[model samples]
Target: MVDGTKKQSLTDNTIGALLMLNASKHGSEIALREKERGIWKETTWAEYAEEVVACAAGLEKIGVKPGKAVLILGDNRARLYGGMLAISMLGAFAMPAYPGATLDELKHFLGEVEIVAAIAEDQEQVDKILELKEAGAKGIDHIIYDEARGLGFYEIDGLMSWDHLIEVGTHDLNEAPGRRDEILHRSKPEDPAIFLHSSGTTGKPKGIVLSQKNVFAAAKNGHDAGAYGEAEEILAYLPMAWVGDYAITVAAALLYRFTVNVPERQETVVRDMREIAPTFYLAAPRSWDQMLTTIQVGMEDSTRLKKWLYHFFMDRAIASETRKLNGKSGGALEPLGRLLGELLVFGPIKDQFGMSRLKNAFTGGEAIGEDTFVFYRALGIKLRQFYGQTEISAISAMQSPNEVRLHTVGKPAPGVEVKIDDSGEILLRSDSVFAGYYNKPEASAEALEDGWLRTGDAGYLEENGQLVVLGRVSEVMYTAGGERYVPNYIENRLKFSPYIKDAAVVGAGLDELTAMVCVDFEAVGHWAEVNGVPYVSYSDLSQRDEVAALLHEAFQRVNKAVTEPLRLQRFVSLPKEFDPDDGEITRTRKLRRKVVQERYADVIAALYDGSKEVHVSAQVTYETGEVGKVERSLPIREV
Candidate 1:
């Protein structure tokens, strides 16, 4: 074993080098797995190293050079992961963009980075890049596609199949076998490793360049804090472009030798998760919320006896967790209740959600409902919240077992320093902090002051060192009467209700706050069926008087839990859900507040004008690229 000093010393090696080390240390160990055709395929560390080397040789032949950008567009699959490693092995940075990015967003990202080559998962992704090129997108010289099922006839220049690339590398290896070694040996920890774009909630997504050192540091900190070992298993089911995925799947897994599993497809994650039963999992609050929703809906449809037992035990678990939240040890029945709950209800539920083997589960990206947090912890799932941004390499603060608290984002991570600015903004400096934004020097300069990153999120540090993030500083609004409020805090409270899926609160300059809610379609639809409420589409269901009443009751519960000044007076179910495609929410599912406010300006006007209903012509975009308008009159209710 290494000494403490040696243990703390950061490695100067790049990820390619780390992969080589793992291959040398555990050549036979399974490093990766992917589900295809209902079969789970494994990749050993030795195979992983070989693939990276071959892909790197192939990429080198295609003009990928040191300091160049290689764009990777795909899901969490073996080829995509290997491509990322290959790009790094060549001393080139990998820029992973969302596979679901719109053509316009793709254009913007492609324009920002001088991408020399691109690796796409399938024809769908390749088509996006090809379309961009057809529109005169620049800098992209080569396109490498993995799944070539439907691209037999496409005559796109600079395009090559993945297997063909490997074959090309195999042929080139005979001529120049030392090329891969030379490239990897020259790569250093401080060299640029990946380019991750920000969520672009406030504006266009900015490229955040992270060095090998930044990713290594981030992974090391997480591993140290969580005591993650080689045995740790994780499902890389989230978007590959997300920084969180990069931190967990790419950085930490490579450094710590954890086995990372990829699902067959996005739709199959829930089912596939059970088979993997990942030891450590992380997802945004939205995903956790959806999981919770699934559980709640399942419970609703369960047999009477099962429902009764579930509620009984669940209440006890909630009580036990509540006591813990208040800093109490336990009540008289806490232990008995927890025991019975785990045996009767929580155990099977955890198994179903694929948390049976989960040592720790994290939810972040936004504030989760306190009820949701309590539910998971009460069920014996070790759910924790973490707070970070892309600029910080997707991690800065995370909750430990002892420091876990409801609604709090916990303390600074290991080797990370955090301070609350005089303006109530959080500032952080860490080994994992990214170097700067790519191509946007002015924005980067504004984001970093001295060495501290101005997190822009308004929050405070508790005496116990926990960080309480309260929405964005700019989003902290004041009423016309001068009472300040954070809309996100209130929105979280509203979202605690099972009927509410999402909500946007508006008050800012008004005397009383009003909200627009997106009803949980599955839950409310079931409720509608049970109550004999006739509704057709989402708009139709939202307009029903019974649905309005249900939402009003939910609003009342939220209002009762808050102060008088912060209570919402009027609320209306949105005629439609805030969709990413509609520009109402970001790709990260964060509400584009300015976009929402402007898009529903008429509804906001009606809410304040004492109108009983508001007529809206919602612009609906179909998957086929057809735009249609749906006109509806939504009722406005006073709580």
Candidate 2:
């Protein structure tokens, strides 16, 4: 096992100390870039350090103390990042809540912990927090806002602007120069740096507390594994509340002195990513699937000549790649074919997705489809899979370039020890393991044993020492015929088709397996138009016989890979997508099995009772926060 405790100059220091060191060594280097009004704005390391110091000073003046929790709510913004660091500098815990969480969810999170102060992005977040406070939420003494638009007229207690906070801090620092040193020295390596929440797929989310040493250890492991290099550029577009974002963008960036680029808005991420062309990137499996669908749809709309060229070259390249992955040699003409394909098709596709400069790309949070994995590798992108959890600082294992495999998540990362229990649960031990669950000693005890953190995932090691992660142990289901299977494995395979978006497989204690599928409206709509099949709305198009036939062919392909008993016997194309606001999925896009099963009880019954169709009246939350219901008669198709 790799020793994580091997002394490095910055490994023992807190995040605040590392920021100071970067400022001292590379003061003039660009540390961050943000898009504003369609122009890129840069911030130097010295300026970044200065702002953090000012923000910390201001927070101190506003009664923020050691061991307190400060809430950060927003998208990826430079000022929000600065606020996180400032909170760390003052020896307080930086608690980042999901920006899209409803007010009731926000209230629940607040009730779980005591929040002393909050730094919000704009009027929307400010309004939510104020509403909660007005509803009797306690311990929130201060609320600071970044954007001033639409918030100027309201006069409320303990609400101030970010600029005003910085001004107050700047004056305080000028008055007492030694106060800066005092503030910096207050935090130790073992002090809690961040407070994060679990995904809550099973129940109420647990609060996880991670120390500075934990964050440093995790970042060191990734650095030693060659995940990134010094001076590399990365796009910070993931949710700020996610542990992966904090591990890479905050911890790893400070450790390696990398440059982070922030997009202007959530909708413009693809456009901004292409403009940035970052060297290192990470995205969830769903995001990758969507990008692949975009490429496929674009090709479908291309001219005849271009479409033929794309298919000919792409098919040949994918075949060659498959042979290489299977440990077989490609023919002599493979090199020439690859060169031509790169020049004719792959090069332009990479440019469109801003992957030309990406040297290291990773996908985590869920299992990615094999087709999706092979497609990117054939297109000349170094996309790999990683296995991790919030308790382990976001990553425990990641596939290296030379060790790429379709099933494994790669060998254990540096400093992580992995072993399987007798019952087949994966257990991990490392310095990066979190301290404990905040305010829940019982849950903490259940999660940790001795020094090893019980991951609650079932998996085994390959002969080559690579880790093969199955779905959660609790999610492993058995059919009435005594066949055991994991639903996610089947769901991922069905989702490989560009026309299919999300899926849920259910067969526990039943005679045969079945599925609830959500179709990709844009992809299927394009296919319909090209084939002379007319449609009007998503619901109308989903119930069409043509759509059912298309999905049947896709299911038959997936069924060929599994045993007869495990194959999907039936499936239904739902009229709408699973939404987070409706509580069907988490913010990270993980399915809440209990919630989904309960909400679709009638549909599941129909799938097994020999019914040709099921009527669904699903509740949907719109972008404007309006609640409504969609009624449709969805057809169930046999494989």
lDDT of 1 by residue, 84-110 (tens): 978877777798888777878878877
Pairs of residues at least 3 apart in sequence or in different chains that clash in candidate 2: none
| CA displacement after TM-score superposition, residue 493 of candidate 1 (Å) | 2.8
Q: What TM-score does structure 1 among the candidates reach?
A: 0.95
**Relative to the unseen true structure, what is the Cα RMSD of model 1?**
2.1
Q: Model 2: how far is 37 from its true place, Å?
A: 0.5
lDDT of each: 0.84, 0.88
Tens-digit per-residue lDDT, 1-639, candidate 2 = 112543655557787777777787788999999999899999999999889999999999988877688989988899999999889878888999889988777777778767888999999999989888888888778889988999999898899999999999999999998987676666888887788899888987888888888887888888777787778899999999999999989988888888999999999999999999999999988789889888988998899999999999999888878887898989998889889999999999999989989999999887777788889999999898888889988879999987788889998999899999998999999999997788888988988999999998989998899999888888899999999998988887888787787899989999999999988897899889988999888888888898888899889988998999999999999888888899998888778889999999999999999998999998899999899998998877888
Q: In candidate 1, which residue ranges exceed 4 Å CA deviation?
A: 1-8, 331-337
Looking at model 2, which ten-residue stretch has the lowest summed lDDT? Answer: 1-10
Best by TM-score: 2
What overall lDDT, based on C-alpha atoms, would model 1 receive against the true structure? 0.84
Residue-pair clashes per prediction, in order, are 0, 0
